[model samples]
Target: MPKRIPLQRRGRAKPKFRPRTHKSLGKIELPKQENTGIILDLLHDNIKSAPIMKVRFGKDVMLLAATNGSRVGENIMIHKLADLPEGSLVCNVESRPGAGPKLIRSAGGAGRIVGKEGKLTSVLLPSKEIKKIHSECRAIVGRVAGAGMTEKPMLKAGAGFYAMKAKGIIWPRVRATKKNAVDHPFGGGGKTLGKKKTVSRHASPGRKVGSISARRTGKRRGKK
Candidate 1:
């Protein structure tokens, strides 16, 4: 009969492993929403005032509200909030949003919609002027707000308050300044290096405690 051999235990059993998944990492995805409410209001107001509008050149018009009624190839006015009636066309606009109007053809600045006619949309720009825009170019309704001014800055006070609580650090008053040498070297004032006195010359042994000597190592044995 063969001798019964004992099973030798090898290394400790490995723990069951799980591959990391993005779901476990706690990342979240958010859906984008259309920001057209203001545009819709402007269009509704425009249509209510005048269903049929004509755009001319050399006339100054103010956009009273935002809108979406005007299309490419259609004439429109730059009616101001103060003066809605008696608009001009000699200095008016001529191009629509979808139609490829030349940048030089814009009477006003880029993104400005003109409301007059017969006036040359393109101007003889000075040599210093780098941009070439068309006067006839009309921007889509609700598209004329200046850069980033329409959107509100996100409120971070709530998150910041919670973070400060967790870190056990009080939010200091806005005007408070640091006291004395505890501040970093780049900090203000003649408080440079503060009350701590400089070390005297040849105080400690060379390369010993607190010395600025170069590092040296003893010769190794039998390595020549």
Candidate 2:
């Protein structure tokens, strides 16, 4: 028998909201892209937004953006004594001379060299995880441009449709419970099965969905 793929069993893993008593606020806007007034060859037309400054390691390879005052053609190195460059979009900081960068690879992301202990350099990730890496590795400078891209709002359904279309995701998704039993696993909820929200890891395709292969369910109790 072939292995069964686990299915998710829930509407969504989102929090429920209570209606606001005060006047409802308008919709939220997306963020704005930071334009550094400079452009590079490969990064010009590919991504959602451009970086603040194009950071490069050597002749060929390119790195993330450098925000603040770290300009387009400045060089900074990682070491034990001095601090890292003040404002740069740094990512994949190497561990040692030969070790490649392995951390902080996102927009508006940068690593702080917390301290050094022997051969290991403690780097604070964007997620607050402190990683110990080699001290000789280098980190680019700058917070990526366009960190505030989510501040802007579409304010229209058509805008959202185009956005989803650009990402190649299917819009207007209908729920399984809303479907007939013949169509989906959670179908026929009125008669088939609405109470059972969890299924085994190896459930057949027709009976999947819910908390498939769930180790545990129900309310979590707090320690008194």
In candidate 2, residue 87 scores what lDDT? 28
Model 1 ranges off by over 4 Å:
1-132, 136-138, 142-186, 190-224
Q: Residues 1-224, candidate 2, lDDT per residue (tens digit)?
A: 53222122222322222122232122111112221223232232222333433333333333444343454445544332124432223454655544444455445576776777776667677898887876555554445445565667979988766555444444556676777656676666575566678888887765767788887899879973
- Candidate lDDT values, in order: 0.27, 0.49
**Over the full model, what C-alpha lDDT does candidate 1 score relative to the true structure?**
0.27
What are the per-residue Cα lDDT tens digits for candidate 1 across 51-135?
2222223332222222234443444433221122212212222234223222221212222223333432332222223222343
Q: What is the TM-score of each candidate against the true structure?
A: 0.18, 0.58
Give the number of the best model, judged by lDDT: 2
Give the C-alpha miss distance for residue 58 in model 2, angstroms.
Answer: 5.2
